[model samples]
Target: MDFLNYTEGVFATNTSGNDSLETTKLPTSKVLLTVTLSIVAILTTFFNCLVITAIAVTRKLHHPANYLICSLAVTDLLVAVLVMPFSIMYIQMETWIMGKVVCTIWLSVDITCCTCSILHLAAIAIDRYRAITDAVEYSRKRTGARAGAMVAVVWLLSILVSLPPLLWRHFSEEGDLEDQCIIIHHHLAFTLYSTFGAFYIPLLLILILYYKIYKAAQTLYMRREASRASRHSCMTNGSMIPSSFTAGDGDIDGGPRSPDPISPPEKSFSEPSTEEPPREKVRASVKAFKRKTRRPESRSESRRSQLYQGPRISGSRERKAASTLGLIIGAFVICWLPFFVKEVIVNTCGSCSTSVEMADFLTWLGYLNSLINPLIYTIFNEDFKKAFQRLVRCSNYL
Candidate 1:
């Protein structure tokens, strides 16, 4: 009886110890979250890398619009490389193991990349608007020096915007716990910086640019339709004449009759033939119209060739590239808006109880934005998609 009691007590103790250890392990929820975020980071990194590679290698994609896409790819690639790895490590450990220097770098990279991306999107919109509305003038005016200046301006603005956070000591303080470099969120500063610099102004600019583009496109389309209708009317009106009338017929009111029965063949041929007269008139008119049209076409074609012959700007691929950029920017806004809104509420509403878990989840959700942009471009943009497929095929063969 004594032996049995002792064995039972040992078993109970062992079970209790096992239960305690299990409870002490990180929460299952946290483990799952870490796993999910790591997966997202890996996927985002891979996809952005592919985008960069495809754009770099493809000869046909060297237009100005492609330049913007390449810029976006670079930003996203930086996000995946600089920001995501730290994020995954932080999430997995449930702490930031990196020291202050590394944390500052991460924060700087995050802000710079994101700001540049948004700015690039705005630049793309502006480029497209110019291309569609002021196509002729833009073609004549936009030179390499001009485009280069624009790019430099964008980067300079991005750097300026990103610098303030780093300079202001927003990220210098160590976390209260062992593992993280937490941001010192000053409510007023956060509100002003994030709202004005990141979300509000950028979004407002995008809206205005897109609205203007839509209106301009509509007006141009209307004008094109009107011009086509007017041309058709002129052609129809010019073609119509009494079937019996001929150039040499002298049928005008009170006009004298021709003197000779021996009508010269040249004059006779020049006169509209009675049989199939309308058809012949239409054919002659069409031939004359085509001859006139050829001059403009040749000039435009020469100009287009000249423009493309120089250093490839990828600008020719503007429409698809612009749409791709818009999707990325739109995605960024959608993904990050909720978190920013939460930040605002937390800052303003003193009574609101915010949890670390909630903040982490939202942050990870924002990180997911990095993974989506490359995929969005690949799926929607034909040039990128083809380039991607070609790359894959090349890889498989190799």
Candidate 2:
């Protein structure tokens, strides 16, 4: 038993020496990986800081929605500051260098921060769904206090999900796990619980809310299109009845009529007046007829179309907001789904495994969501972009 032993074809141990395991290092140069991770860490920190600063300084962004966005930015900022640096080291070194206490703290922060970030995404989705589907009610309900309450709940749930491993302390010897900071999966029940609470359920909620939001947006869009078509139809109908339409020589009070008969009247009908009507009198009669016959159909139709003005503007703004929310939700799912699904698969199937590289890639993909979030949610927002520009220019408040 004094001979060296290897497990999983990747980790090696020597029986004669103090217990230790040698994990295989990546074939690529460590320098490249280090540089890449450093860049990502810096970008994550810098961009998230920009979002925080932009929101803080922008007075216009002081609403409940932006408040939630600021909370999200804070979560991402903490991830960048507390998780990514150590994670980069872990990935490159292929082992944990931080001591037990630091390792525990790192893992907790990592899980808590990411969980909070995801929950914030769900909260934003719910906010958008309400804001779209029930604008008046949601507006009255969406206050800073409520947003703060939501943020509190998000962090509390995140803490709950992240604390079980630390509390259980499943490792038989602290020394054995000193080199690695990972979830202890032997506690299968808690692992599943934590994973479900942290990822699956939140994802389900987000999907449901966004689906509803999408339906509401589609309805609004269809309604607008229908109204537009109706307005067009009205215009066409109103235009078809020309204002210049004139009757043949007949009474103008009614529709077009036939001309008088050419045959002479009967002699018994009494002799017709021989004198011709005066030109002024005939023109006056025609003028009276035109005045009596002219209708204000075009004016009335114009007024009817004008009635849609308020709703049209409101619908446009709603469509814009829904589109923005759609983009945010889309980015969230694309960035996090793979990682969460992989996590579920790996944890659910005991024999399932993932290589260090694939695991890191998936984790980083999820982290990339933090980076994409600000770009979609804030940078793309007109008000936020204006505020950002103002901040950059050091412009005085209006």
Candidate 3:
């Protein structure tokens, strides 16, 4: 009896000690998660705020086209400020931190801002397409007010897409609903509706617009290259003819350094005409070659002048559009597709099980897109880089 009692006491003490340690201490994984999320949130906030400041201060960045970019930065900034921190806290706690009201607000802002960011991409694509396809007309129309109106429309549409969930997304007074804050994954119809509206529809539009934009840009680039090749070929032929004539003269005139117009140089080959000497024949051939070479000078000059002046600025713009569009579409699709696809699969297939950890990871993956936006914008845009350098040098407001 004494030995049994001692064993029971030891087992109880060990179990109690473990329980206390478990409750008080966080694992390495959780600590890493917290640190990683905090860093992402901070970087996202800093980068996006830098973009806004750069745009505000730099005169060169003050273009109608860049206004849409500023709006995107604003949207991503809101996501970093309002959505990510709350999400990090909720993930660490393994439940919602704030009450239902705050949860509803946070979820709504998350959806609206993310949707707004996606819509901003679509809007910028349209702006680029118009600029490329109809540069003359669209330049007139691409004003500051026009970009502002598009930004307004994007926000309005995002809010409308997120509003329906509020009507049916009330937390219950009891059970599993009270502690968790998640999207309406149970309703297949709304899930399809929101995901399609927010991501898929805009994705389709981007695909079609970028396809046409790529085609137009390709044609312009090919034409420019062809004109250059033609000029180069004419110039090469002209130069070679002059060199061949110089060599012919040196061979004919006993290694004379220069050609004398009055004196016809000698040549070994004959034209087989009794009326003309070899020297006369060579002189006539030289004159004929000169005429042929000089004939194309006028045409080449006209083409060269046009090449120097025409489409130079638009070429840079088109290149930027091409490079930036490809990257934006790729990043957008990679970051958000898994989460939306998971939602679609789990919601449509009622028998599918949803893991909270999986859902949270996918949601944060989508949120990672917000962080990617500013990086893509600043890295690709030369104007942004200059402005950022200037802003960093003179950052009183930071």
Candidate 4:
């Protein structure tokens, strides 16, 4: 989140002199900023906690895919609880009054949690792609243990990506650092590694996986629709045959008439007509049996309801794939891309620099992603919606 420049930009305000004076005389803008960021922190925590609670309480939402969501919510919850408040205080005070120990903890947790959140998105994209593209095989593969393992991997990678900054920043012996909590990254390579590992690479992977999922969803949906259409047509044509067979069963009248050999040539034709009733009965019986055995819900709906619980997952899903794909991609990119891009540019270009205000804006834009994550992940799921409603109702009752 351009945090390297971010610390400097914010701290630069107080680094000159008179930190105690500035902290006491808060500006209107800083007060407004504090209020705004405090609300953001509160909402971020509230929403992510709702997500975790919803997943935990709702048995219907207990699918392997949802496990990843719960983990993401946990990571975002950490961001809100552990990271955002400190950032807001820093913004308000314009200096690091907190001790070095707290700064070390804050910076480490900040990078780790944010990196974990981004990696969780990538993991979710992979799980959905597998479910859509390989439903049966993936169904077996997508278990609680597997989801746990995925979460573990995401956290491991996050820690690995964040470790360099945490270790280096913690051990730094730079003087006059008491007023600042900046992680001064001297090597450009670390910036590239951490940024790409934390945001860029995962986002690129998610985009590609979602694209593949979109195509697979389209194919499966069309196939299911065609199957339903063919079944409907067969039933429609069979309806007429059932009516004709009704009297054929009672052809006690027709059979008796046919046996009257007053015109023997007619007897032969009537005999063939009598046999047609048995064949029609078999066909009608088979159709009824098939209908009885068929599931109430279609395979497509069942599979997709478990997969993401987003939409129809067939006709409407196909039509809305672009929108869903775009929203997911756009939210993440809009939130994170500019900050990372700025980070790269500033790191690579010696003279290029971003103002503190611009850097803070970009950083918060990325932090907003923690709030956005739960909404995007859970809003479409009816199970989660119902669970949230129940929770809210219970909360009100209390």
Best by lDDT: 4
Candidates ranked, most accurate by lDDT first: 4, 3, 2, 1
Candidate 2 lDDT over residue span 72-112, tens digit each? 99999888888888877776666567788887777678778
Q: Which pairs of residues clash in candidate 3, taking residues 3 or more apart in a chain or in different chains? A: none
Question: What TM-score number comes out for model 2?
Answer: 0.71
lDDT of 4 by residue, 1-398 (tens): 32466235533454456666665686776788889999999999999999998888778888889999999999999999999988888777676798888887888888899999999999999888777666556667888999999999999999999887777666666323787777766578778888888888998899899989777666555554444344344434443121111111111001211111111211111223344788776776676656545633443344334334332445566667778778888999999998888888887887788777787888899999999999998887777888899898885321
Worst 10 residues of 4 by lDDT: 252-261
Q: Tens-digit lDDT track for model 3 on 47-71?
A: 9999988888778788988899899
User: Candidate order by TM-score, highest to lowest?
Assistant: 4, 3, 2, 1
Alpha-carbon lDDT, every model = 0.59, 0.67, 0.70, 0.74
Clash count for each candidate, listed in order shown: 10, 0, 0, 0
Candidate topping TM-score: 4
- TM-score list, all predictions: 0.65, 0.71, 0.72, 0.77
Q: What count of clashes does model 2 give? A: 0
- TM-score: which is higher, 1 or 4? 4
Model 1 Cα shift for residue 344 (angstroms): 2.6
Poorly placed runs, candidate 3 (over 4 Å): 1-26, 171-176, 232-323, 395-398
